[model samples]
Target: MSSVLPMDLLTYWNRYAEAPITVEESRERGFGWTQYDRHGPAEELLGQPETSLELGCGTGDMTAYLARKNVRAVGVDISPVQIEHCRQRWPQDGAEFVCSDVLTYLAGTTQKWDAIFSNWGALWFTDPRAWLEPVRDHLTDNGVLVFSCAPPVEGCYGAQGMYGNGFRGRVLPVQRWAYSPEMWEGVLRNVGFLEVYAKVLEAPEPDNLGTLIVQAWAR
Candidate 1:
C-alpha cells in the first residue's frame, strides 16, 4: 500500500504544470535518470527498445526523446495538466500521453512493452512490494525495468513524507520510497526479476545527494 493520498499526489504534481521543457533544454538534457544534466546508465541499459512505456512521465521530455528515436513511446501521468502540457508540446511527435494513476494504468493495460521505465517517477512514490509484480507482468519476455530516485536517508528506509514546494509555502504531503542499492536489488529479485542490478550514481558535486538507479530484467 502507498502512503500517498491520491488527491494530494495529484495536486502536488499539477503544480509543475507550468514548468516548460524547451527544445534546447530537451536536446541538452537528452533523457537522463539523474536530476543533473549528465546522461546516466539508463541510456545504455535501455538500448533502443522497440516499444517503451514511461511511468510518471512528467513534462514528457524523456517520452518525446524516445519517440524521436523511433521507438513507440507512451507516457503515463496522473496529472491531467501535465498530460495536456505534453500533448500540446508534442502534438505530432508520435508520443502518446495518458492521464492516470500508474497502478491503475498498469492493471488495465493488456499490452506489454520491451522497456518500462520511470525517472524519479512512480517507482519511487509507490509501494514496490505491490507495484513491482504488476510491472514485471506487463513486460515482454526479456523486458527491462529501470528507475531512479534519491538514495535512502540514514535510518529512513521506506516510505517518507516530502513536500512539493517549500519556498512557496504550498507544501503538500507526498510519500516516496527510499532504499539502498542492495535493498532495491533484493526487492526486484524477490519479485521474480531474472537479473537485478542497482547502483547509486554519485552526484556531480560532493555535497549533493546521489541518485539510486535500478535495472531489472523480466524472466
Candidate 2:
C-alpha cells in the first residue's frame, strides 16, 4: 500500500471522495473553472500510447478512459478508499489501480511507460523536487509526461493559505501548492525533461485566472 498521509487530510478526503466520480470534477468545482477546457489539452498531449500510467489517479476516471482506448493503463493513488472506489467503478481488464504513495511506487517499478500524466493529484500535496526525477527515470526514452496545476492566488502560498477551506464550494480541507508556470517549466527542465512546454488556459469565468498544462518529453 502507501505511507500514511497527514491525519487530518486523510480524514477529509476519505469522507468526501465519493461526492464526485473523478478528481477533475472536484477540482473544477473547487477552483471555479470548467473542466472541459483542461480535458481537451490533456487528451491532445496524451495522444494514443500503448502503455500509460497516471499518478494520483483519484477514482480512476482518467485511467479507465485510457484503458477503454486500448492502452495498458495503470493508476496509483495514496488514498485506499479512492482506489477501492475506482476499482469498483471501473472493473475493466485493461486498467489496474494501486493504492500506494506515488514516489514509493515509482521507485520500486522496473517498467517504463510510454506516457505518464496526472490531473491535479500528487503535484498538489508534495514538493515536485522529490518526485520529478523519479518520474523521469520511470519513463521510456521517448516517453512523455503531462500534468495540469492550478495557479497560485494572491496569498495562496503563505502560511494562512495552506489550508484551502470551501475550495470548489466544499467544506473539506485540501493541501495544495501553487506555482508559477515559469517555475514549473524550469523544474521540468532541471530534471532533464526535453521539449518542455507549458500551455496556459484561461478559466472561462471572466473574473478568474487559468491553469497551466505542461508537457515534457523524456530524454
Top candidate on lDDT is 1
Residue lDDT tens for model 2, 1-219: 233346656665666566654544633433211254443344557766899988988877778777877889999988788888888777754789998888989988899999988887776676676878888888888888988867666445511233334445334445566666676777788878867887677776756667767889967
lDDT of 2: 0.72
TM-score between candidate 2 and the true structure: 0.80
Alpha carbon lDDT of each predicted model:
0.85, 0.72
Off by over 4 Å in 1: 1-5, 163-172
Worst 10 residues of 1 by lDDT: 1-10
Q: Once all C-alphas are superposed, what RMSD does model 2 give against the true structure? A: 5.6
Residue runs of model 2 more than 4 Å from their true location after superposition: 1-5, 22-39, 154-161, 164-174
lDDT of 1 by residue, 1-219 (tens): 335466766777897776776867776878789988874564677866999999999888889988988999999999999998899888877999999999999989899999999998877888887788899999999789999888888788888876765656555667788888888888788878969889999988878988888889967
